[model samples]
Target: MASGVDLVIFGATGDLSRRKILPSLGALVARERTKLRVIGAGRSHDTTDQFRELVKEASGNPALAATAEWVTLDYADPASFAPINALITGTAVVIFYLATPPETFSPILVAIANSAMVTKGDPSRRVVLEKPLGYDRKSAKELNAQLATAFDESQVYRIDHYLAKDTVQNVLAFRFSNSLFEPVWNRNLVETIQITVAEEEGIRQRAGYYDQTGAVRDIFQNHVLQLLALVTMEPPTTFDPDYVRRAKRAALRAMSPLDVTSAVRGQYEGYLDEPGVSLESRRETYAAARVSIENWRWDGVPIFVRTGKALRRRATEVVIKLRDAPLDR
Candidate 1:
């Protein structure tokens, strides 16, 4: 195995980094025994030692801290990326993980393109981006076009980490491997499918990003839609990633556009009081929609998806209701 790999995280000081990324890295290092050189990049003035301390606290791994480094990166200034370029060697396998908001994606991509960190079509270099990729369809396409300018499609990974959940992955195996479920997985025997992702935690430090993104763009657009696709998509020809992606895309294409009448949006009671949130903000903390797929397997079946924050309890669940058994006269 390669001795080590370089991982540069853009929003290293953010909540996502502290709560999710760093902790995961600790586990990764412990389990896989992979040598990772973690370079935490942000606009913060944290020194290398201070950043390492933060890494140790977040990841609960001293070894990760021992090899950690920090660099100052300002999305507005392309020149700020030089330190990052200097840290990485020419032949090193570098993974640039953009943990910042979607709005900053463009400027950062431009900076990365101008830097020596990425070489087009080089498999050794990769970029991992979090969603929502854009505000809407047109912007998503534009962002994708910009990415193509800097890196090959194969080298760019637009990821939704929710898909990595064991239950989510099991959705595929449970449906395909089980003879009992596969036969009745269609519209004939299924009544409705409900996918709910609820959280008790408020926006907290994510007020700026969450306010602009709202519930739809934050959760519904990528995560909820992905779950729906996995549940409704046809069996792929093979377990290959491309084949699975094609099947998922086909499932999404078959979904009817969400009707305004079938959707509901609301803001939590104390959401306005959150810091950094606009006093006049009307963004929804909760969103629900009734969706349908026109494909033969799913026609006439209602698929309801709802996600919210500061709710009664925290849960992520998918409920598949089955139709009543036939009566014998």
Candidate 2:
């Protein structure tokens, strides 16, 4: 860390880095951003020049890659984090992005905790965990407990890129900023909130990961539920981080209990034939659930969240249906 913060992306050789993170960083560097330093870490033994070349090849921008430094180490060996530790210089903030999978998260966190990167309640250090936090409540809690050993809640950022979409990010502004909507944003006027995240591409090269994760663990647990929360959350006391986060937590707490009868899971027609997929796999490429928020404002409204892969549309959208007027009939 220096005057600005250091952003270290673990699993730099993975698909996430090549596809999203690196490209986004390239774009950011092309714009107005200077002091921030970025370091890419992974198991790649490629030299600094080679790794920079890889970044350039993936991002199609030489300047951004030119600004980055690479650290290579075998993920299985916790002792190998020494190189990364050596790079954590100065007193500026150090932000670690766990760009790897959920399985690798714990080991990486433990390794980080063992290192000097994360000390007792160090606000200068932060960790960002990507989507698919955990499969269920129990596992989610387990992961959270593990994460707590390293950093406080404020220092951990559970990120869902979908929530950052322009349309999705404007949810709070669209609701509270408008005086007319909040008054009528209740079950009396709204019928249903349907959130659909559909992906047209089949499991191309992620069969091993997808088979275990499926739509429920993959999308519903993070993105779909987050969409539901945004739609269901109460107007916060103020538009600050603390207030908004508490409001969301309260709203999510009021969410209805899951009913097996109201849930559906399905696999695409050709999913069994995907490479690395076992024929006996009952993995679901699609999942839909009907949830009810048992709160003062959303007592009877049903929030329907659904997500699927290799489906009709490649889109993420939230639709709110209004109740018809009594005189409609």
Best by TM-score: 1
Q: What does candidate 1's lDDT look like per residue over 91-125, in tens digits? A: 35899999999889999999999976788999989
Candidate 2 structure lDDT: 0.84
For model 1, the stretches where C-alpha displacement exceeds 4 angstroms are 1-3, 326-329
Q: What TM-score do all the candidates reach, one by one?
A: 0.96, 0.90
Each model's Cα RMSD:
1.9, 2.3
Candidate 2's residue-wise lDDT over 1-329, tens digit each? 45676788998877788888888877776686645566888876868787788789887678767767788876778898988888877848888998987878878888888877787578889999998887777888999999988788889898888876898889889898999888889988998989999999998878757888888888887788778888889988998878988998999999878999999999999999999999999999999988889999999888888899999889888888888888984
- Write down the lDDT that model 1 would get: 0.92
**Which residue pairs show collisions in model 1?**
none
lDDT of 1 at 183: 100
Positional deviation of residue 110's Cα in model 2 after best superposition, in angstroms: 2.0
Error of 2 at 108 (Å): 1.2
